[model samples]
Target: MDFARGTKLTIKYNGNVMEVTYISRDEDYLTVKLQNGYNITIPENKIDVLKSSEPQTVKKKRITLKHGNGTPISLITTGGTIVSAIDYETGAVHPSTDIRRIIDRYPYMEEKYTIAVREFDNILSENMQPEMWIKLAGVVKEELGKSHGVVVSHGTDTMSYTASALAFMFESLTGPVIMVGSQRSSDRPSSDSFGNMEGAMAFSSTNVGEICISMHSGTSDNSISLHRGTRTRKMHSTRRDAFRTVSGKPIAEFKNKNVDFLSEYKEKSDKISLSDKIEEAVSMVYFHPGLSGQDLEKLSEGKRAIIIMGTGLGHISQSLFPSVRKIMSMGTKVVMTTQCMAGRVNLNVYSTGRELKKIGVVSAGNMLPEVALTKAMYLLGNYPDEDFESMMNMNMRGEIMEREFLGDCY
Candidate 1:
């Protein structure tokens, strides 16, 4: 049977009958929107259509967005689920660069801030690279000159990594730089895009001058969290509250359209200082029980820096010591970070750690593995060789906490 878009239909599937709105159909399956606002694709041979009706013609008015009287805010879109929607004809979600479509969804944004948008890139976060981070830093610098703050829309998969890189690259910021992402696509019923974006905009107007991430504070839509970029990580695969601060508390929380500070944060500064240079010759290795010295050596070959996600208190198999020492002898820097979620690496406590440290394995004090990797990249790219080891252990951009609070761990 043929039906038009928005045609109401009753279908029987697996001994159950339900109503749905016809969206599109292909050779093998039919896609329809359920009452709860989720779209499900049912195999054509599995469902029996009991009744159908003609589509209704409903016109939507075009909303015109104008600059608001408030301070200027710049939005940079780097393609992600936050900027993606379902294509009914294909039943697939794709990235979009239509700034108007996004702004129209939240008209209040233009009503409160003079929003300026720039499409930095239209690629997923997994495709993000160091070169792109350099370019993005430049773009953000330019925008900061004209806007009170900037908001970045990014994919959740690698949002933490990009956020960490930016956190390290910008030594100082004139205004807050907020990175926001959603666990689900914008077209889905349960998408967190709006709340995250709202929180980002709200945070952008604050006196904070740090790189932070704005995401769902919990499963519900009541609150959004503002996490320091270097301390944040994507903890869950598909939950709205996927992103969390690993070893620290969020800087602030946004609820009921109001912002409240939870932790100390940097106030807005007079000028933006950025070190966009990044050494891309960096590799991150997760040490496991059976990883051979040969394998470790092969992975470390020709790399300027390597970040190892080691076991508790930062330990690799004793067998890999030879390879690590050899790598260091060749002028390579190997940094040790804990694979555990919420602890610092203390090389002085364990013989293995002390031995590793003796051979030049720097300890990353409570720094998340991803943050350590990005910090290594930033340090190697801009600093001198003599200062590399010192800078790695320093609490730069809040990546390395002098002490970890017991309550911070979940």
Candidate 2:
């Protein structure tokens, strides 16, 4: 009762050392906000403060509390533009672990969900790697067992790649495993961080169970679209609605503090599975005019699988056929996915494609090149005995489009 709000103190309780912000208290108990964005009420007799509030370093601190009878959602943080801020001293924007600030700016979000923040990584998404993906999978796997759902806040640069990877690594996930990001940082007035985060929390509490993305649906804050993890892509650099669902409509949309399911989704199940295995000896090459067979040869060397973002219809020049043949002869898997975003890759439709297939290259159908790469790694790591060619073309997690289309489409 003597402590005031915003008081910084070091407290030891339940065998855990935590730096907390002292909030108000009731007649019987005292409430404190933990460093990791959790609010817990404890008996007054249990309080043990090692330090008290001082004005020398006083600054704004956030206090968060769980909503009564609210759904429990794990907020896993991976460094991205969404949680980044410009370090005026360094003149560069860097990922910040101060996630409580974001929640503080949007206090209304805590009213709907009992949020628990977990820091998985604090680096830019561009720095994401296979090992990080494996670690993230393990963390998500553990969290899903205890929480109602999990929401990952990641950077937009490689957010889709991580989302696609998680879609395959975690099979038969029942609860909503949604990834959310901000196109703009929180410091700006026009930031999309608030809407995207709000939408993700809303979607996470729903019955729909799948790995998905919740982001801006349009330029305005009208709605946030929920896209299947495998079918989503960041289509623009600066737009709030940068991510678009490829070859399919968004599975659901969040608006007016509600999630409206637009398409049928995997319902929440009692079981969840995870596979952290990944073969990192895979690479991708984007085909362009005047690319050499020597380049292809070198790219395939010491690689288990190579994904080619080939030209239209998934064709490569006949000049590179010899190098491709040699690579496959050495037991390297060559998979082809088109640079074009919307259509299925057909090796039999073109002369160049037919020639490439004659040697050993396999088509990735309508899978995004990034998805193809991750799937290749996943298959090579987990199901090494299975036929990868068949698996690549199969509809696993809705990565491939059922019907092929021509021209520009979203």
Candidate 3:
């Protein structure tokens, strides 16, 4: 018998019957998640009670709210720190979720509309491949034709990549596409699972347009913030309220069961999502200190488009100029974005700016690097079939913030 992530089983511990909603397997121990959301780690040698009985069958009363359904939405889960749990045996975290578990936990959502859930992959977001993005984009296309909105449970790490990719691919959208992750795992006492899930549920079940990341905007379950997918970033590693709006502001807020908009949202057309395809080829190269041109060459090889995550206002020195020009000369579109997660890139401020602009490097404005990478993918996916440079320079969603508004922590 396979003990998967969301397996429903019962364990009789100390004469107490506890349902094992989730299992975190480690090298030498197993951590079980209880109904009330607690992880009890038991070594393989614990007293008896290892029987695999079914969980208690209890009927639940549903509490639901009204929402929209004209446009279909889907939630794709790619394994990340958010869905991960402790495997005591290995002392490593494992990401696992079952669609049934999600639905069971939030049965109240059935009242408003319906949802379709799928797991894109079970790897950390850092391990998310561009191929996964392609497959996920395809999933969105399929779901857009079926559901009203889509929510993604991703690791906070590479969520911005998927979010930006979807935002770019879904040109003009009707329903919402939300990416959600937690600062802590569902097994931890202070995990952001419940809050993040609630916020994502609110955004997806509502009549919002465009792709966004729904996460904890502040500590303590006070509110869940909906940020423009392209403009959001995880600001802290351990803080529950780690996600923040970069340069621009969040799209909206979910508090006390209410949806409060920061401003008028982009209206959705009859064609909800942009209804498009991604570019076939693109590469993302992050600029670091003492980086060599060969590094750029290796990534840009055979790539038709490149997004450079430059340091500080999008400035790269003369050392890698030859590589930048080489890629541009090969008709490989290169975009310049800031390594500073919180600011926009301005090529006009420095001599390096003139050099990059001279070599056909484009400024990505306030677009996040992940957004740029996904945008490049979406644009490059167009390939010989489409013009990437033209689309890559435009704002598909809030990915490209025309203006920057710097602010202090909320």
Candidate 4:
């Protein structure tokens, strides 16, 4: 392949026209940005070069095919920093669709596992909707049922949110369903994409499950940590390793080309089942100093559960406390989660906490309030008649801690 950065070229396939103005030749994939404003990674071998109209500066392209154990790895694209490539015009990065190219560039990953890369969509994790999750669920069902493990490339901002959603959707999911993303764009030299993907793929081939996050355990390439989706949180804005599992220990680790487990994971089962009936609809609202109750009106139409991302220690103003009471009394189950990224939600710490709890706000206890908000909808959708109190408070797929202190007392 003679393709290089700034080389003007075009590609076509089944109605999808891809023009290459900028090319990032990564170790595993050839990242090309289409003139149409989206980025697609074409494995170097997949380049059906239409033509080179301008001068081309050929950069060395490294492609390798290495295999690990005979694990079937499925890389599902759900839009995230991990799969996005560099933009030549503004230098901004966009969602990527070429997993095979990544695999080829980093042959060490492909050699250890047979990988499948498919793009479901190119939206940031925060932009993800339940309908998208439903679609992703179908894609995951198809892959995990046949593949040894699966990796979902998602945007870091909403990576934890989707992971939490999948944890609730997957009933007894066996094997690893890893969601990997990069806090820093992969265009940067210290980007965490490859390492995160490697960790995720390694875990997917193993027995880890529910939905887990494969990200920098620390701020380096030396190690990657696997935190359960429902338990993990993105704790930084610019750091390569930002996702962390608060209150709970990690599910596993990836270091030095090996998968090590700190805890056991969900295993493969005999009978497989699929359900598409989802009826739950919930919303997440951040509680601010001058918060209004109109947002609760969206949930007020019917029996809706709302999760309020409250201030420190789960405190909401006494003004919203009445609205909280109103929502609870209106048959909408509202839960409370701390805005603090770390520590648990303590409803008994202050009178405000006690007042909200008294008004029937379920304590989310650092469960990444958005996950609680989303899960509420999923369960409500599935079991329309079930009590929201039990479902919201109950530890479904390890989303909630058993008590305030489930670890060392000190």
Q: What digit string (tens of lDDT, one per residue) describes model 1 on residues 1-410?
A: 56776788899989999988888788888889886778898898999999997765434222223566877888888888786666564344555545566568767666688777777876878999989999999999998998899999999999999999999999899999999999986667998998898899899999999999999999999999999999998988999999888767899999988999999998989999999899999999999989999999899998999999999999998989989989999999999998898888999998999999898899988999999999999999999988988999898888877666666454
What is the full ranking by lDDT, best candidate first?
1, 2, 4, 3
For model 4, residues 1-410, the per-residue Cα lDDT tens digits are 65545667776645566656655677757666676666766666655667776644333222223366557777787667778775556245555555665766567765567776666776756688777778888888887876777788888887787788788888766567888888776667877888888788788877555788888888779999999888777777878767877776788888998888886556655544545444555677787776666655654556577777888888877866666777777777777888876567889989988888777778877677767767787777777545666777677787776543355221
- Candidate 3 wrong stretches, greater than 4 Å: 1-75, 81-121, 272-276, 383-387
Pairs with backbone N, CA or C atoms under 3 Å apart (clashes), candidate 1: none
lDDT of 2 by residue, 1-410 (tens): 56755677788787777787776578978777777767778997876777887424333222234666677888787888675666443234555545566568666665666777676766778999999999998888877776788889998989889999998998778689889999887878999997898888888888776789999999999999999888888899999999988877889999887789887677877788788799999999999999999999898889999999999899888888888988998889999999986877898987898888888788898899999999999999988534888888788887887754342354
The RMSD (Cα, Å) of candidate 4 is 9.3
Model 1 lDDT on a 0 to 1 scale:
0.87
The per-model lDDT (C-alpha) reads: 0.87, 0.82, 0.71, 0.72
Candidate 1 vs candidate 4, TM-score winner: 1
User: Against the correct fold, how does model 4 do in TM-score?
Assistant: 0.76
Top model number, TM-score: 1
TM-score of 1: 0.82
lDDT of 3 by residue, 261-323 (tens): 885566555675443566656777888888899988888888777788888989876899998
* Best candidate according to lDDT: 1
lDDT of 3: 0.71
Of 3 and 4, the candidate ranking higher by lDDT: 4
